[model samples]
Target: MRSMEVDMIRTLETDKAPKPLSAYAQGIEIPPGHRVVHVSGQVGVTLDGQIPADPARQHELAWENALAVLAAAGMDHTHIVDAHCYITERSHLGIYRATRDRFLKGHRPAATLLIVAGLADERLVVEVDLVAAAGAAGPAT
Candidate 1:
């Protein structure tokens, strides 16, 4: 595997593996001493418990809420090493990617997208789960 370290996280890619089709890495190597954060899947529900009917809005809110969790952990989008996004409809892929890409801000992490039959709530059309890490390696590990 070939990798380059960005913000103490290593992004993995190999000629033997197929290149990622979108803004994501083929793999991510988390170095030692990095504090790993497993964030729960954030759905479309607003802080006030509002669930937007628009799929695009749901996608946006899901990402927003997930990022908020990262912020609480003292991390940001750049610290993310992996992510999985679930969407209710195949038709929502475009908006999903747009919102994801915007929030990621050119930071590509290992990622996957799943089209699911439905979420916990019918109105919750989108959900985002993330794995993030930061901190220097070595003794800290």
Candidate 2:
């Protein structure tokens, strides 16, 4: 079963708006013929399946987990078009922002941050999910 190839993707940037704070484009323009990949929410569990105690550590781990999902789909951070972040406490915003900025470096994709009452696990301080696009489609089932 041969797979279909996707078209190239373009990152949209304009000086009209403030540059993205991290390693994501302000917007990603998917060509007419492109497919989207949705990565599910990822928590901050470590390789040993243990959630960290510090909120900042958890935030970093969550981003790593989400990026791992994109990588599994043969996409890198540059392919990300959007990201959604969830945090249990408002006080963690500063930490979250700093951690995200470090992880993204320069790519700033469309992003949304939400303060929630709690997460699926009480030990989890942050969770992140992403949507990405690549230049190759998947094989048909």
Candidate with the greatest lDDT versus the true structure: 1
Clashes of each: 0, 9
Residues 57-127 of candidate 1 have per-residue lDDT tens digits of: 88888999999988888788988889999998998889988999999999999999999999898878898
- Candidate 1 segments whose C-alpha is farther than 4 A from its true place: 136-141
Q: Assess candidate 2 and give its lDDT.
A: 0.78
The models' CA-based lDDT, in order, is 0.88, 0.78
Alpha-carbon RMSD, each predicted model: 2.6, 6.5
Error of 2 at 28 (Å): 3.8
Best TM-score goes to which candidate? 1
